[model samples]
Target: MSQFPHPSLPSSVKEPWLAVNLSLFFPGIGQLYAGKIIRGHSLIITQVGLYALSGWLILSQIGNIFIGELLLITAFALSIWGIFDAYDCAKTANSPSFEKLRTSQKDPWLAVFLSRLVPGAGHLYINRLWFSVLFFTFFVISLLVQLVPILLKSLIFYHVYIASTIRRERNQLPILGMALVSILFSLIISLQIFFIKTHIADTHIIVTNEMKPTLQRGDHVIVDKQIYRFKSPQRGDIVLFSPPEPLQDNHFREAFIQRIIGLPGERVEIQNGRVYINSQPLEENYPQKLSQYSFIPITVPANSYFVLGDNRNHSYDSEDWGFLPRPNILGKVTKRFFPPQRIGIVSS
Candidate 1:
């Protein structure tokens, strides 16, 4: 009792909610706010590294995949752990036992937010030299993991094909070794590219009103390119594709997404917002209605398709651009991934 003394803290100090909010903004800042400097800094470093690794995997898959999703879940768990730890630290901040190891260090929320935008930045905010160096190292490592493989693969191709220029007199075994290396390198690169182009696709929220009601403004969807490769786009299927002709004047070069109104060789007609296929009205369980528009019956040419937006009146689809050639088809929309309320399999 004589050796130990009561802890004194700022009268205005409110640790609990403040720490919780700080940790929410930046994974470790709340610990710093609650005088757990080392714990806070450690979390800052760990969280940033975890996120960078997760992001690298996500971009490598080129979008959502099982591995990337798992990585993200792990990252989220780390953040939650940090937040709870912060709350605990904050609760004990004013205790005499905590005072012995408590730090006078302060963490600016502004700095935390800045570091949130750029990893290891919060350390720089607090002017921690060693911590800043640690963050920079992690960032460099992240960049290396993301870019080095591609660069190495490119160099291999460049040196073997362009720089060296093939020699016929080379030894058989060495040629075999080079062949094996080239095959292995090519396989790695091809797999990444194939996954990017064929498996996963990411797109922003659609602003075009053509896909209203079913998919409105600020709705985003994931495209699965592998689907079309296995089977052709069928009627009522929502698909994304490079438009037959793009609006080069407006610099709008994005792939277009529209529901397939008619497949190749099908007779399609629209009468007062209702779509008729082969002289029968198409049945749709989805809550999308075509806008009022009368269109003459047209026979879809070979290897071509007729597309229309859910909002028929506002959409500039096959009606404006004629038939969509099979080669122009890009992928099929699998799910809506953005705007939380509308997130789910967008199509049945």
Candidate 2:
């Protein structure tokens, strides 16, 4: 065996051999090789913690904050620190006595961020087959669960004349009266030929009578589907929607018109023609008379609706058909244009 003196290494040689100062450019590397275990751990922990916190904040949809800016700054700084620390660690000569510890090169944050954009890419790169498959599955499921339905509903509402201008009111209107007005305007525009041809749907109203006395048969009414689609539909707001059974049917699952008597999750009862919601008697302002023919009380299903006709005794509606599913509801009926004489704003 060749006799050779092992190159000398200082016992406490600049504890941070990797240059902790360079860590400001990249988060963990400087501490990793610097031999300062606690400090390095802290740097890595802070970087990871900050990144996680920023991601959660973004998912929350909380706007009007400087979080994004701060995150970007920290990320850039950490990346730079990592690059410099890596260069310094590689340059430090390994002593012969101890086996040379060749530092491993990695761009973990960069790889993770890029892969996350495509869902499962990073895991695939890391050879985590199961996690990659799970990520891809969840990604597809999320698109179907959230994005697809929203797009479908938007298209349905558009065909039924729920225009975008009024559909966007829920986000803008704070006062109830303003919100109601917005719904009214949305309805009026849906019936006009100009509006109909343009495919605008807006407004909310309830039909008390059959198409004959109330709205002429074949006359199209537009309802603001976006109002309650975003917020909760109120007790008096006349919502135009389709019943669940018809929706379940293979054909004719497009749209149906009706009035909102009870909101989702509320108990509704019709006794002797008069209406009672949650055991409280509902007021009838439009119909000339009240006839309590059906005696039934039901709790409105979640994300579903309870509807009725203005002409209680004559009209066939939820009392006869079934609770209307919110998904089937294209928009709220806001306007009636067939019979000129009966043309006026539909009231709550």
Candidate 3:
């Protein structure tokens, strides 16, 4: 035999479990840890590019539902592939043919997978005492706080069946019927929540004081997406819409919430802290912290609206970016339902 080591022999053994956990945190990290430099870099670049393209599509073409869904599916598939590929690479590096590596009785990778299903299960399987205890404790607390109430509610059906069977032979039909009813109820509720969140309305937590007094920071509100589909937005309506391209360059990515000050084809101007519409001073009823900044009279274009924030000086709105296109409007803020003391209809 030649005095040379076999080519398949690894310089050092790689831990399959550690590689998998790294990949779980981020797709390429596990591969990198396993000494697959080129593969790791490629995966990282691919993931970053996919995420960037998806974000651009979301911000620029929010109406393209099919394309967005396709991108989301693709990202998920790639992530799963990356995770499995990392595990396989680590196993290959630790193969018996390469070198004799210490093997554990329990598969750490299996433990990791099990942990995903039940928070602490994987740790217990792998003999990670401290982590297992912590995760199990958290899981128990969660079940007690959230699931216990639901279980108690289900007992009501059991009580109802008992009361109805007081004078007759008890049968399994009642229990089966209760189970089916519960399943049906849960399915219907899930579908309705999905529909409402996707098409009818959505909740947003206000993060800025731009619309102060009307909608303060930390306030939670419901945006009515379906209303604009039926009727055109009116002047004085508070709307949530994507900002102009130039404003986005300044890292303003979230949708802007503002009040419609000038409707299509109307002349609007701000002079000495007073808003003038079509050369006449508009009556003000809403709470506003007006600014002294003067905006020269400008007529809004067709199919576009001019918007302003209640906190004029603090807001970056149509006054800075010009008219907002009709297509850019996402929805109107209807009600605030958070910070219990400030919950009410958000009127213009």
Candidate 4:
């Protein structure tokens, strides 16, 4: 705690509910109002750090927002903690952080109102030069953190300089350090964004209802692009492909995804909707629909493959479009990421 003297107070002063509400929008404002500048600054630092770290970690998984849950949970926890702490301090009139406002000086109401409009304005009104400068620094740091997209930023980590230097007189080092850190974080975030966009991962989404009840439409999936480079897409593996052309209602002329129903040089047929390979029943861990449709056994071409969507009744597959050309094969779908409740690695 600072060795600052408390200004005397009158009898009728009420508790500082205003500070609690202010803390809701701006984390440090309540601490400033209660004369707990250091505590307010601490809260500001903590909130900014958590937010920046979250941005740096998992911010860029397109179409699915799995990373946002961590951010939302941390933010909610911080807000509640800050609000309750500020309110408690305010109600305890003698708390070191809460000081009685002097009526002879600028009204507390005016100070709070000014801070609400422009954060540092309240400090400026009180003629506190250093407080004004510091609050503005914190505000700018927070703004920078919030402005960028989901990418990892480390700018706030440099607050260690300011936190440690809070009590040093005539110090300009922390400010300079903060500016440098901001520039560095900005550059890093930009570079990361470029790398992610250019180095498109082996990630894709289940884009059709043909795999329904197993892989739903719009489910973000990770494909093992590297695996097929060494080995073939195996039986029952969910593979993403460059479909030859538009099939059924799917007009995609490029990448398509389906389960490899039969591998190279194998005989495949469907009897009463149960798939058979080489005249023997094929056991499948994945669900199969019962249908009376029968397919005569046919040998899969030497280099080509046979494929089908799990949704047999609705899907246009090898049974409809002949064997899936081997060139159309890309990689296998390995995970699902949409609909946060069921987010996990795709099995089977």
In candidate 4, what are the lDDT values of residues 1-348, reduced to their tens digit? 332123343332333545564575557767666677799898898888776665434333232235545775787798788877876666665533324332323433344435544656656665665766776667766666754321112222223223331222234443354345445656677687566543433567676888877788878766655566667778888888776654634675757777887888999999977989999988878865654578899999987888887788888788888888777776667656567776755656
Top-scoring candidate (TM-score): 1
Best by lDDT: 3
Alpha carbon RMSD to native, model 2 = 22.0
| Residue 290 lDDT (model 4) | 54
Candidates' lDDT values, in order? 0.65, 0.50, 0.71, 0.63
**Candidates, ranked, lDDT:** 3, 1, 4, 2
TM per prediction: 0.51, 0.38, 0.50, 0.47
> Clashes in model 4: which pairs?
55-151, 56-152, 241-256
Write the residue-wise lDDT of candidate 3 on 1-348 in tens digits.
Answer: 122223444447676665776676568988998889999999988888876676344323133333544675788799899988998888787767432323424443455445544556666665566766776666666666744433433333333323221212124453445445544565676688788776777778999999997999999877877788889999888998987777877887888899999999999999999999999998878999877699999999999999998999999888888889998888888777677677567877
* Candidate 1 ranges beyond 4 A from true positions: 1-75, 78-194, 246-251
Model 2 Cα lDDT, one tens digit per residue, 233-314: 6665565555477545646443455567888889998787678889998886654346557667889999877877665666
Which of the two candidates, 2 or 4, achieves a greater lDDT against the reference? 4
Residue 148 C-alpha lDDT in model 1: 50
Global lDDT for candidate 3? Answer: 0.71
* Poorly placed runs, candidate 3 (over 4 Å): 1-191
